[model samples]
Target: MSVVWYFDFISPFAWLQWPHIKALAEERPVTLRPVLLAGVLDRVGQKGPAEIPAKREFIYRHVLWRARQAGYPLHFPPRHPFNPLAALRLCIAAGSGVPATEAIFDWIWGQGREGDTIEALAPVATGLGIAEPAAAVADPAVKAQLKANFEAAMAEGVFGVPTLSIDGRLFWGSDAHDFALACLRDPDLWEEAEMHRVAHLPVGASRL
Candidate 1:
């Protein structure tokens, strides 16, 4: 089973899930699917939670509690950018073994910037002990490839960031973290549970 992490760097929930989502794969066959989150949101007419006063308030309280429970650092970012696809693309090209993956998430969600240029990203990249050349990836090809990745995601029915898509079923939002983790960490239990929260978990008669 595979997990597609349709995330935008602007999503605090996506940021919050990064460490745990990676942990869920410790003993599993999961890979990160980084896509252009803004494209999904724009195409779907979905707005970032931070733009919604009530929803933003809701998420702040929710994330604080989840952070406490998850035992990880958490804070609402001071500023939120509407687009994060470029940042996600850089990380996608970055090897999975690199430490910069978390740095990318933190730079966006913790410090509240997309690290748009190589100069901007270099600090985070090297801080995480990864060598990031600001010039090498300036080619048009890199940008094109990233755009194509987003297109592919849309073809898969992805309409929002923090979307967890497995097979053809889509679970959108930060609240679905438990189901996503369960789908990866405890697939059988997910299937057996009343609601197969994650998309691909075998459900209905499939559970039996």
Candidate 2:
């Protein structure tokens, strides 16, 4: 089965996870599905880590530590929680291939560039051989494709960026990459007693 990666450019974790997911392309088919993280969060009725004051500060520090530990170069853009609609649509316009996808991630996360506006992302598009970045991303079909991707992600129960779906199982977050890889190597691991127990664990209480 193919690995479907649901992500949004607004997430640094998605950027951090890009290389590992790209590596998987060498072994099997990998599809890059760009969707709006904001839309997903709204649908789930949850605040993003960055949307919470204390968690925002902690998450920034946490990701920095994780980047240092992983030896991945990371620089936050001028801002966090910027609009990523243009960038997401750009991915659809650019065919969502490895090169284009990596370049978009690198432009924002690696180079610490702004991706909220079409003008800010024009260079990335031009470099990728798309002369008219704004026009390309504004295409009706491109916008429609991004919407479709988001709808499909919702249908698949994806609630976060950088979620990996394989063989009907979802592994969310960059930290879960190893576990996803292990499951990929051994699909039957889900059959373990602990796995079954956790799957049906009873909730003692609920905040809702």
The top-ranked prediction according to lDDT is: 2
Residue 53, candidate 1: alpha-carbon lDDT: 92
lDDT of 2: 0.91
Cα lDDT for residue 19, model 2? 88
Model 2 lDDT per residue over 1-208, tens place: 7689999999999988998988998888998899999999999988898989999999899998999999999999999989999898888889998988998999999999999998999999988889888889889999889989989999999888889999658999999999999988998887799998999999999995
**Candidate 1, overall lDDT?**
0.65
Q: Write candidate 1's Cα lDDT for 34-58 as tens digits.
A: 6666667688877866678998888
Where model 2 places Cα greater than 4 Å from the true spot, the runs are none
